[model samples]
Target: MTEPAPLNGFGPLISFILSISALRDWAKLLIIGSFFETCRRLLATVWSSTIDSFFLTASFEDHDDSYKWMMIWLSKQPSWKNVRNVNISTGERYSGNVPDSEGESDTSGMPKVCYLPALSGSYTLWYKYRWMRITRVSEPIPGWGPNHRDSLNISIFTRNHDILNTILQDAKKAYQDAQGSSITVYISDSANCWRELATRRKRPLDSIILDPGIRELVVEDAQDFLASKKWYAERGIPFRRGYLLYGAPGSGKTSLIHSIAGELELDVYIISLSRSGLDDTGLSELISDLPERCIALMEDIDAALHNSLSREDTPTPPNQTAEFIPSSPRTPTHTTSKVSLSGLLNALDGIGAQEGRILFATTNKYSSLDPALCRPGRMDLHVEFKLASRYQADELFKRFYLPSSPKTPADDDQEPKSNPAQSHLNGSICDGGSTDLIDLGVPDDVADSPPSSPSACSEKSERAALTYTGTRHRGHAPKLSSDQLSALAAQFASAIPEREVSMAALQGYLMSQKSRPSEAAREVSAWLQKELATKKAQNETKS
Candidate 1:
């Protein structure tokens, strides 16, 4: 049937044949080109996903100078939390002609991988698997097990202990927990947990529980203070609270604060004005970004005062030059190296919204504090954490000696539950041996009832004592009166030398004493003796 079609021009038939061959070759080439392009795309996607998943990130936009400044400044901070064995992949390389820039690969920034047990009683760190990869988990890991050995062995084998097995396990767990049903777990080389746990080395707060007498007095004040915080919260304002604790050097101010944080189930954001080199701007930014629910503390406000603002009020006749200028040198006058108090003030409770910010400022010199600082708008409640009165001692004992546990309501009293005197005490002391109520001397009669009855001890003077005990009461902490707490705080404050002692030091000391109560007690007694001796000598000199 096709034989009839051979009757065409020779030139036309030849052109048609050539056209057919050209079309066939073009089709083959297109198919080959498409296959290569698909493979390249797939490889790129795989590489990017792997990098993104395996590494933690700290993004800094290349176009912004602030990003560069942040990186440089962060690098200079010796105490900054390290990023750990992380491999950073900056986007800049992916910009312009390059891809995968190595600028962010500062291994030094990564945190050192080390063993950190879960604070919760759980020994297992929980992790989940996704898409054949361990994704996210938050459960505690075995404190000591195969994983621990693997971590140590890895350190030995790779000589790069940076990628610790325990750390990987931890990171893997966290990743899996966060990923949910995702087939991928994005493990971070470094855990932000280090930054949080660093303060674990701090002094324990329980050691400064008040003596029975002081607890009675201070417990109520603490309650009122808490009530005030709740009052603000009830109005729908952010449930932020600020405390200004000022008193003698050995007062239990700092200890009281730590106890409050622990009892309230809150995180503590401690800002040592003397240490963290925070300019007004830096302090403000840090404050602004603080977690919505936590405590922000600034210890020793008097020492951190701005010299300029202080001088402004000292009998200076409006910009008058000093009568006696410095004779040391015709030195070029420069702005005095002073922190801007106004800047700090604005950063705190400025005209702007500071609704949810909880600030606690402590100092031994209340007189040195500016009146404006303690004015109604700023530190509205000025409570002095003072020496332990008789009432404070008992409360302090209860807080330190008691073992916190979930309690059943007590039915010991037939008096109306509404009556402050009839409030039944719940919760039991820890199995840890109990110290004699007054073997060391000091009144034991602090309070007879539970701490929930704020009204029973609700005098303004008793507010601090009652409120302080309220937090400890539910947590298996000892139940000391305000008087006892005050004395305990005083005892603790005096333990450190006259020189500046950090909250960390205090916390560490307390933790040490927890398992060794006798040692802690002896240390406390010795410190108190020294403080009394010093006070007596000062009085004689004044006379």
Candidate 2:
């Protein structure tokens, strides 16, 4: 009676399944599969542990300097030539050109291409007789939409950690060598992180047309400060220096800073105080995060804080009279910057401020700044950059028109002779000082002739082609010896009034007459007269 009751539910089904031979065989197969899977997992765990013990793994994030070093090193590896899967990058971060496989010159003005390991791909290469594996992975960053973070993982098949250090040293050396000719410029992002903006060619200190002894003073001071770190520490003073370059706009303040950075082999970190979303706390954080032995630039420092307070908020001078005050109701200039004067002061010399960093602040209005900001400990040295002087104008003109010196016989003897025709074609002298063009059947009349002008031209076109037209020309200047350049430079400087025009204006004037040094010197008085008259009229209008 109990069996009859159970058959109504599952009793009949269980009995039917147990009676089938195929069902029994299926159950046995399920048990066997489970056992094999367990064994496979156990073996995998053991294999992973063994590999980890013998392998050294290191990871480099894309944002870090080491990542760039590794990428450059990897690009030069012989293994990449044979690799089929790779990423082609034209970014400056990779540094140097990838050798063309077909040995053709790239004259297209395109950025150099580099081969990088593809994302999520594994690559193998040998380093110092040790097998190495590189894997580049990209992962989505949380809270950043559509933005991913890249990382490089390197696994070396060795038990010694010294091999990794050696590889890193080699990579770092290669990166330094590649970057030797340029200086890296960094700027802060909205997220308050320093990002590489560009790699500027190292501008020689001589190329900057500063007044005599001004360049020497700033450069020597910076060099001495950098070398006197131990002296500062011994005296219990912070190993930091600040320079205040206050004067006229376009007076080579920023250029001087850039040249100093290049001369000192230090990277430049530009601190934009008026940047959107940047506030007091952000500025302090940025300053604190600056690297040691780096240049921290804050340009237009006065403008950033000039309009921070309204006229009513600003304290009236003790010497001021009621009549001296402006009758018009003055409103503060609107700025996206939330940085205050106190915030900037603290950022410059706070306890958290980075040590050994050289800070450079430039301002067009020196007298407008608070005295506390220009104090000894904060500003240290205050260098005034007035408008361009006659010396600067003279030096600039010579630099613009002077040709590179010819090689001496001693220097020429060191170089091995290549192709005679090619050397002559490149303006080098062949036997009897004849050019390769003559041998190529070119007539002397055609070779020596100047560039031809258009047969038909309007009066406007002829005037536009004049040196004083204020239009830029790309033609090469006539090759002048040092003495000839000095004569032209002196004549040009005589026409330029001292401390009236900025170096930038003179450079612009020179750029317009790039191919006509003689014309530029002769027409300087006319250009200066027009420039000064225009400036006076503008000033009168403003008044």
Candidate 3:
């Protein structure tokens, strides 16, 4: 009964047998191919899972750029606080980038910083529909001992491999942009702790008025030197800049230094030589721990430590020195001052010195400092801040007085006044003569009356009244020309003969008579004469 299928004809039976062999061969090949295909799919799934959970990490070392950027990035995210304990260390930010209810800008008093999450905490951030997991970890490498300096870690997890890099780059860019608004200054309070002393509002670097050559040179050097960090690394040199600003008091040394700091947006860490507890060790520590992109200012250093460097030569400008000698500083007699010359020098160019520091040492006594301290590399550029030149004085005068104009603002009633104070904004002045702006310091109110005879319009008549025009506290800007101020500045500069009058004195004098440009111009000569006389008398007394 089981062998009944063999009843078919022999030809049909042969065909069936061939079909079975062909089907058997095809089935065997399919099974083998399916096995290989399954293996390939399994491998692809494993690789993709490994990559998704690969655990890419970025360890943050204290004071490192990455660590700084991470902290800054954490401070910016609104959702970060919800994930972490962020109630402490909160502060207000004043950048005007925030928006308002009416779609207008309202940037005042925005929250800047809040305490971020501690270690071993995880936060998930979503951006552009892509989710990223951030886990704070401090796993140690097998050989790295416990309490490693770089123990802080920020583990970034994402399915998209490129997301982590993109996040880090965006953070770095944000940190840079945020720092552009102000400059910070750090002062060393303890051996390891540098307390933030001040945060200076940014000033336009162009506002610093110096000799044109000096201004150009300082600006160019600052830009070139800061940008040349890579150049310095290749050459194996510390990326630093040093400038010595020395001259008479009130010559704008300190102001120039501040301007440079503002221009570079670098913090200024002042090492007060006169500070009671400061010694060589303390100073060295301060120098070594200086954060990157900072200016270390040791102002009035010549007077701070009484180093008995040679003072035989008269103080001269850097360019004026026909005979420049790089003298090795002679040791001074041991003084009560805590700092020593050797200690100062070692901290300056020491092997352990911090990189990316700009140093400025200002002194009134240019010849008083030790030569070795002022040598090249340490004091790469020695600039003497002298009294304001006639050109500078003219500029100073215009700067002080030109912004004072606008008695008749466009909204302040179109009606003209009969007096010089309220009426002189337009080219018209209330003078008795021609109804034109008194270009030569003469106001319209007191100008000599139009000639009834030729004798009435005399030069002396108009010039005499010019003396009183600049005395009033008029809100209007001066009608004086640059040429006119230059004339007065030339007179002021010429009286001293030695260019000994400092800008500080000139500024004070001009500020006192700020409302009186004509009076300032005319009286500046007398003031300079008196200043010179007093200085001479003081020198005689000291001698």
Candidate 4:
């Protein structure tokens, strides 16, 4: 008693289950079905086989060339050439493969396809005469926790492995050539190769607040490094540069590095030592293969060292007295990292190390660093970033406002106020500012550097400094004359006690004032007085 046949058979279910792309490919398959049928019979009669196939699987979770190649190739397939419905998204990418223009080198304005209805399920990827079936899948990886990220599994099957490998390599090369760089970041997940580091575009150098001396030093060194690559080979130098940037967290240490990368037209390779599975071998391999003229940055060197090795195992200098900082609340009871100080030393300039590399190590705990690690050959330059200074405070005010000095007021009524206490009136502190009043802490290179696309904050300032744009503030209000601006800058600088405030704190204060320079100045004055009072009170209480 085989039950009565169902009204609708498996035929209807098959049609319903097949995706549109799959259906289209199936039609093509049927057209060539006879050809394949004839070959199958011939092969079967001769070799007892119908066809050969190579199966390849790719995952979106992978951050390597294999995954990158597959995903890029999939995007170029003709099957989804004319998808009816697509989701597009914009992103900022910094590619290391191409020379960057002056500004926004790390940015991309292109839109990416996020969702393709036609390629949502099964599809066909055809290159040349070779073709393969592609299926999109989302599922958890075996042995991973349930909360782990889902990976998109892309399966490709073809009759020839040669075509698969060749097409993939060619496709990657073409894609990179067409797009220059796609804002990809590479890192080490293990001892094998560098994986992409996921991060947003960084601030330009001009956007950062730094000592002019350091900026010049960095750029000149970069120039020397690039020009001397061949020279180093001609001579017998290692052709490597190492910089140590140590300071408080918000002192623009990292921002300066990003700016330098853009200015030098080089890519940045960041090393995150905290990443699990990284050891001495992996670290050494990473350093030895750093891109030429590229910056190999290891941020928070002290923290990584702490996790990698025990405190007693690390060393300190005998002559330098250590400054005592309160223990961080996040002290870990135990760590599995095997990174050691010696291992780091070996990674930097060991025999296997690559030349034409700009290495930067940043940390707030300068005192904790072993003198051996930062000795002459390892870190050639050690630059300390201090808190806000009088010069910096003046620059901050000028940055928050326009750089041009206000036009000489035709009448006294239009003159900018000179009183620090009354600067906030008329909605802007820079209403009657002047550029000639002070050098404003600007650098020679910054003034001399080509003013292409300026950094967000540096645009107006550069124009004023370089070409004297005399660009107005947000409301198009005229700037103060040089005398007025100089007076205002002096007042602002005087109000800020040198080395007493952090740039981060000063920035926060300025932001709170909105774009009102006068308001920021007044409030900052009151705030400083209160801070001084609070410090005195705390000191008395402690005593």
* Best-performing candidate as measured by TM-score: 2
Name model 3 segments beyond 4 Å from true: 1-124, 128-155, 159-165, 227-240, 291-293, 307-338, 403-498, 529-543
Q: lDDT tens string, model 2, 37-154?
A: 9999999999999999999999999878899888878877777678889898888877553665586655555787888889999999998899999999999876522367899999
Candidate 1: Cα lDDT at 195? 26
| Cα lDDT, all candidates | 0.43, 0.78, 0.64, 0.61
lDDT by residue (520-539, candidate 4, tens digit) is 56556887887668756765
User: Which candidate leads the pack in lDDT?
Assistant: 2
lDDT of 1 by residue, 426-500 (tens): 223211112111121212344443434434333321433333321111112355556655555555544444422
Q: Using lDDT, rank the candidates from best to worst.
A: 2, 3, 4, 1
Candidate 3 to truth, TM: 0.59
Candidate 3 lDDT, 460-520, residue by residue in tens:
3455455443333324545667677667556544444335667787788776576566666
How many residue pairs clash in all the candidates, one count each? 102, 0, 3, 16
Model 2 root mean square deviation, Cα atoms:
9.6
Pairwise TM-score winner, candidates 2 and 4: 2
TM-score of 4: 0.57
With a 3 Å backbone cut-off (N, CA, C), the pairs that clash in candidate 2 are none
Q: Which of the two candidates, 1 or 2, achieves a greater TM-score against the reference?
A: 2
